[model samples]
Target: MSVQDSAETAVLVSEWRDLLARHAATACALDRELSERFGLCMSDFEVLERLAEAAEALRVQELAEKVHLSQSALSRLIGRLEKAGLVQRAMCEADRRGIYVTLSAAGDERYQAARPLHREVLARSLAGHRPAGG
Candidate 1:
């Protein structure tokens, strides 16, 4: 690599590393607090919340897109939730091969229970950074 290009790349990488680290630290702290306060892992909380918000059961592909997860990874996560009795899976009527996932009543209750802590922590974290008009 050319010397100038190498140096620029190094600088960019360093900046990106710091940016990523800061966000990671924030997320880790929030996750730890959430777990301690509500006994919910971030992933579990995310899935439950997504399911609770849906008017109907979500297709696996739709859930994967919303959660920013690969299909396989989402499937594994759903399996865990299913085991926990927080979610139930059903065959899609129109597409027999497609799976639809729905939050169980237990899952809905858990999400509702955790909602306050989730909102409080998130708000507290972001309050300092809110734009003046927004």
Candidate 2:
């Protein structure tokens, strides 16, 4: 309402944006660092994490949805993971156009290796934050 109040609001908004951007950078960096440490790309890690929770296997589209990736992007990531022996794709029995992506034994090992780093990064990122006013 007042000029001072408006200025404070703007500053707060800017600070929030800056914090978000920095957090994004930190997340990307953590992913890169972990990937380098484990020889697994970020996308590859994500795919493995997803499969690790799956009871059997996941459809390619389902994987894409969980990771918020486009079909082509998911396909490329899946291809890399498959080539790395981290995952395998098979034709879906019920749907000819659908593909099922499953984690290989090697993928499970890589995922186990990468999980700790993921948790560490997440904990470090959230360490300084608290409930809005608490």
Candidate 3:
């Protein structure tokens, strides 16, 4: 390849882009399958998975951190899930300003149903994928 062409290719395949590309690929696969089968998006599934692992209801801030979403975004997502009856939200008794989130039975069921597909998609999407020049 010409030097200019090589440099352009390298830039396109930089480590950060490679990482993001791989994530996008895997996320797309997971989203498609999860959405079709369970009516859940990837973020929705992530919220439920995190809530399922919690011993008790998680504070909104805590869940937001775990799910890597801003507090406002998480709140909006929570609102959607709450509307769909997949999750329940309550004001913390100890601190009125605090909000707690818990997975409802339906959320758990959906998460359980989708877990295998999630794993399968992850494996299939990532299989044979590697960083450029690895």
Candidate order (TM-score): 3, 2, 1
lDDT (10s digit) by residue, model 1, range 45-84: 8889999999999999999999888999999989988998
Best by lDDT: 3
lDDT of 2 by residue, 1-134 (tens): 99999999999999899789867876686778786799876667778999999998999999999988999999998998899899999998888999999999999999998899887876777776645875
Task: Please report how far candidate 3 places residue 108 from its true position, in Å.
Answer: 0.8
Cα lDDT for residue 36, candidate 3:
96
* Residue 69's lDDT in candidate 2: 93
TM-score of each: 0.80, 0.82, 0.85
Better of 2 and 3 by TM-score: 3
- Local distance difference test values of all predictions, in order: 0.86, 0.87, 0.92
Off by over 4 Å in 1: 1-19
Better of 2 and 3 by lDDT: 3
TM-score of 3: 0.85
